[model samples]
Target chain A: MMTLELYNYWVVIFLMMAGFYMLIASNHLIRKIIGLNIFQTSVFMLYISLGKVAGGTAPIAAEGIDTYSNPLPHVLILTAIVVGISTTSLALALVIRIKESYDTVNEDEILEIDRIADEEGSSA
Target chain B: MINEHLPALQVVVPLLAAPICFMIFNNRLSWLFATLVSWLSFAMAILLVMEVRDGTVLHYEFGGWAPPWGIEYKVDILNSYVLLIVTAIAAAVFPYSWKSIQKEIPKSHHRIYLTAMLLCLAGLLGMTITGDAFNLFVLLEISSLSSYTLISLGRDRRALTASFQYLIMGTIGATFILIGIGLLYALTGTLNMADLASRIPALEGSRTLQAAFAFLILGFGLKLAMFPLHLWLPNAYAYAPSAVSAFIGATATKVAIYALLRFLYTIFGSSFSFDYMQVQWLLMPLAIASILFASMVAIFQDGIKRLLAYSSVAQIGYILLGISLVNVTGLTASLLHMFNHALMKGGLFLALGAIAYRVGSTQVKSIAGIGQAMPYTMAAFVVGALSLIGVPLTVGFISKWYLILATLEKGYWPLTVLIIISSLMAVVYTWRIIETAYFQERPAGAAPVTEAPMSLLIPTWIVIFANLYFGINSSLSTDLASRAAIILSGGSLL
Candidate 1:
């Protein structure tokens, strides 16, 4: 049942977990963005792998290609990649602003700053 | 000619208008243009609703490509109603936003704010109308990204952190939805919702389908701010500009509920989702917890917006509770509440925005006795608060009444009691506002405040009147909700 042929999926699982762990475990905002990118990449890989067919050529109208890999997932993944890029850029821009405002990007430190502000605002 | 393309025009009008607002580069002009476009969208939505009133479905193909091959725009009783909710809320928010944003946002960022607002409106509308899974994912991102920009535009530096937190959470949620759509596509090789629905019955026992269902529910639950996953909503609403809190607070999560309904009833069918999967068992406890826990938490929040945000989480629980009932009355209650809550919360936020304009903050204590200073706005807020608490003759009572009936129909006395308890909690939180604003006197020597501008007051009252109007009539919304719920729970609309 442990098929070595599904190694691509195994790789996807590994990368998805690694990146997701980084997203949750990391303190630095920039590192969290990187982790998000990695997590997105795993999904991209998942879609790409789902399109493969044994002995299939590229989805092009060539001379003799009876079997061709599915191209729809690739097209969908392209859109996903664009969305992923926008998210990363927006996230990075927010982090830069956050850094300038709080002067730190560490999650705990930022929370501490906000918490102190909250305490003072309430007490005032 | 236009009527033939109502579904297409419904989304395209606002989608194209976003960039035009950006091009205008003048806040006043852009605001005028965006408001007009939102009205146009709302008009089209009303027309679409009329056409679909007799239980007919309207389909528009993208670039002439038929469904199961290309993206499609589909309209029916359910989505047309949802389209009205989003577009109508936008229509109300846009004019109110013109004045509110002037005070809450910087002059230079005004055009950018207008652009983001239009884009977010378009995105929400598009998400409501699209029948393709991938297209919905794309539109969801479009809305999420614009909302992040909108949230970030607030004057407070904390807006940056709030928007960032929401970005992280929203992105994760969208990705989870994408993963779900990918799995569905892998299983069925079709992105069209109707085609997938027709194909799904044969694949009910597949693990991939189950995983897709789980991912979709989890993803949507996060987006809709269902209880424990709602950590991102409070600060995001609290720190965002007043207009943004009003606009997004009204429309965003409601659209998420529409999406979840589509997946549950239309695509997967209720029997598979409820009977086989038993989603009710998992959903019930969480919904109950949200109703009890979020309401309890709302009683303690200092910021009025934050408190309302928590109440939103609990209101969402009520919606989920209705869905979990899997009965027509239950779903009717859910849909009715979605529309009613939009009016109540949207009006409350706009009134809060007016207060913020006059007083500079929305904290409960900061509003002390200013009720006399801003009688009109405070009155509107009081009506909205009453609606939020389900007082009779307001829209809140209409939906909550149906919810109680739904539970009673199911013979679930405990749930009925729980809902009543939560409504009482709503009274507690809202009473604090009433007492503080009406009973306590404004601190001596505070700047003498005037009423909100006519521009702001008109829209707030417009929404507040709708609450009373809809609550009193109840026929239009109740009729539509009953039919839509029947369609969903029946899984027979297609």
Candidate 2:
């Protein structure tokens, strides 16, 4: 039982690490947003998994129910999901603007442009 | 009836006004409405502070649900004091934004700008006042989202990248906080902070609880721009619109620091956080490194706003250093520095806004001879700079004095010396700007510049004068801060 419970957390940790690695490693702005979505979704899943109980039904008032899964984490994650969506949309909007202005969505290329601009700015 | 709802109204007023601001498409009307809402919130904050000054904790339950079940708005001296600073800075910044935004932001984006500003204010106030752990995460996101919008509204193209960087980091921080809160809820079976605090003590040895604490610190450390995790701040500040630079510089991280304090001292309890976890050992070195490292970085920055942004990181170090001391005086210094730094940095940024208003640039070299052209604005900057350096008879000195005393009380003389050395580094950076502005001749063929409009000057000077006034007569701040600190440290000021 302990090994199984530990395995559940291990999956959560694996998803978390994978998501974070993508977020940090990706240079493409759109990919970074995707990475952020995955990162946040993994956290949401973690919360939901924590609420799971063996041999439990949905949390609801009923005439006969011996065990019920906790609904609080579900409720919390629902709100977090909304926040996550909003953040992703806003991030995409920023990427759109960044692409328009810098004419590139690659973080490295954008940094190079900014660096050149900075050099010219100081020299001027 | 209204008095009973002050806690809710403090956040609700700005939250509601944000959508209303969006509806008012006319730039002037939208700005007027935003300013009025900010002032109203500021007034409410003052009343709340006065009510809680005697160590009263105002607990307002939402939807008539008792705490540990229903969400609660908890306003004590600690939060009320922070609320006052946040709203006061908003109140001052909004009035100044009318003119500053006119120049920095496009006319078409003005309404959206005002709306985002109001939303950010509401979200910050909500974050500070909420007692539920989950509610704090929601409010944190609200403010974080709006601030990203505000930062991206800057005229420079780099603002886009800056805003995106901040969004990524802020969302990660918020997620970490959410995970921590979720873990705590699983442990305690309650979302309310007071409930958690009561239950946390019994589960002290649990690894999950310990992990939650670590996550909370790491998350809030990112949010507060603590040391090595502060990569997103300087660009965000330097590229953001001038008014935004002032407003967020003055309030956002300050609120994050308040959140850290609330979690560490109030929820986790000082004993668990400091004694069991040894958070001081973890935080102290980071704090010292930030103070030394960020200040050195500031000394080389060409852009004045970027310089001040790095300075803010160093100042945050001082606040955190106070916390790591884990004593009454240290905590008091931290609390006091939060208020004082708001005044000093707010005034400095607003002064920079005025210069940017006239010269259309914030580069140190570009502002040569601004002392002659924009005397009032430059004077304000000089006074703020002095305070930043922690000179005597300024608000900065009071905080540093308490900090040094706190270190002495702990027999940490070397730490005290480090604090003084950081102040000297501040002086060096500040002098670079002063020398460029006052001594260097205005570049040949440069257009003649005038003093910033009275609208900007008045707010800027009000903040600067407050710095001086509070420095000399610090009883009000010290009294409230000491009492709050005592509460946090589980001691009595008396």
Model 2, span B1-494: residue lDDT tens: 99899999999999999999999868898899999999999999999999999888899999899988899999999999999999999999999999999999998999999999999999999999999999999999999999999999998999999999999999889989988998898888899999899999999899999999999999999999998999999999999999999999999999999999999999999989999999999889999999999999999999999999999999999999999998999999999999999999999999999999999999998999878889999999999999999999999999999999999999999998999899999999999999999999999999999999999999999999999999999999998899999888887646
TM-score of the second chain, cand. 1? 0.99
Give one digit per residue, the lDDT tens place, for model 1 in B1-494: 97998898888888898888989966788889999998999899999989998899999998999887978999989999999999989999998888898788889998889889988988999999999999999999999999999999988888998998899889889888988999999899999999999999999899999999998999998899987899999989989999999999999999999999999988998888999899988888999999999999999998899999999999999999999987899999999999999999999999999999999988898899888889999999999999999999999999999999999999999999999999999999999999999999888887778888999999999999999999999998998898899888775544
Tell me the whole-model lDDT of each prediction, alpha carbons only: 0.92, 0.94
Candidate that would win on lDDT:
2
Docking outcome class, model 1 = high
- Give a tens-digit lDDT track for model 1, residues A2-73: 679899999998998999899999999999999999988999999999899889989998886799999999
> Least accurate stretch of 10 residues (summed lDDT) in model 1 chain B?
B485-494
Clashing pairs in 2: none
> For each candidate, C-alpha RMSD in Å?
1.2, 1.0
